[model samples]
Target: MTTNNPMRTFDDSRRWATDGTAMLTTAIEQLDASGIAAGSQLPGWTRKHVVGHVAANADALGNLISWAETGIEKRMYASTEQRNADIERAATLPADELLTWYARGATALEGAFDRLTPQQWQHEVITAQGVTRQASDVPWMRAREVFVHAVDLGTGLGFADLPDDFLTALADEIRVKRGLSEDDLRAVSGSLPDVTAWLAGRPHGIADAPELGPWL
Candidate 1:
């Protein structure tokens, strides 16, 4: 059931998930009540909203895992309105309880990953965007969420603090998603983290790069 490419294996997915969660946990741990109430990098949301959103995202991904493993059609959320409402409601939790929710959701997601069989990893699941992809893609999906949202928390962490390999993977994935070719934009280049940030529509003050549209 193993592949010649290690990156495609379940072990590699687990590694990415583990590393991403650790980074997110650290960021969450650093937030104080006042810090949680402060506006985050996200346009109108507070740090509490970002944390709650991340926790909900973990639960959503866990639903996809169940869909793959059980051959049942589990929707990521009931609907977008429900999802937003859930985040807003969760964001009201006290800072300590919010962190506890995040930790619990993350652990449940990891357990879901562990339950996946090799065949289940290849099963198709639909994202909230209605795009269908194999379950194997979930790890990188979660990685992108965690890494990007950690920066969104605005707790002194930035894209620069992410691991180089994660940044590289994120950049490559974003390029594919956005239908970007090297020639599509101005010839902008940087370290992997900076490139990832730029591609995700964060301005890095790198002149000559084409102005990118918002990623989300």
Candidate 2:
């Protein structure tokens, strides 16, 4: 299927995934009992929900990685309801258990990636969104989830810690997905990270405009 993205390399995606996971893991590790239960920037989602969602997402993406390696159709989740239920169950765990679950899920996905040959990276896989993309997209997709959700956790971590290329690409992608253009919105100005965060519907201390939304 056609995509706006240009050609991407396995090495670039892997590096981003590794760095993003490291950032997310550090943020998750810092959360205390109260901190996890605290409200996150995402309304109605506590830090626990954010953490739970991220962990569950790793498993879902891992399924895609498995599909790529074995040529089997491993769906991301059995169904949307099942996916939500899984995250809810994860959200109930205590902080230590939660961290362990998150770590395992992330590591499992990484291991799957480690096993892929160069040819497998070019294999087509369907995303939860139902869009078909290359296996190479998996690492970048995971990177987006981990990095953006880390910011959603509402700890001190912000978009500034994310790579500049990621932010630029994110801004472009979100603008396209949300049907926004430079002319449609005000001439907003900020650092690349803040702009990316704002565009992605995360909390960013930038010039105010109309609320943009439910960014995944």
Q: Mind giving the per-residue lDDT tens digits that candidate 1 earns over 55-126?
A: 999999999999999999998999999999989987789888988889999999989988888899889999
Specify the highest-TM-score model's number. 2
In the range 1-216, model 2's lDDT, one tens digit per residue, is: 223375334566687788889998898788789999888888988898998999999999999988989999898989999999988887788988988889999999989888988888778999988999888888889888988887888888889978888777778778888988866534776777877888888878786656787789
Best candidate per lDDT, number? Answer: 2
Error of 1 at 167 (Å): 1.3
Per-model root-mean-square deviation over C-alphas: 2.5, 2.3
lDDT of 1: 0.82
Model 1 ranges with Cα > 4 A deviation: 1-10
TM-score of each: 0.90, 0.92
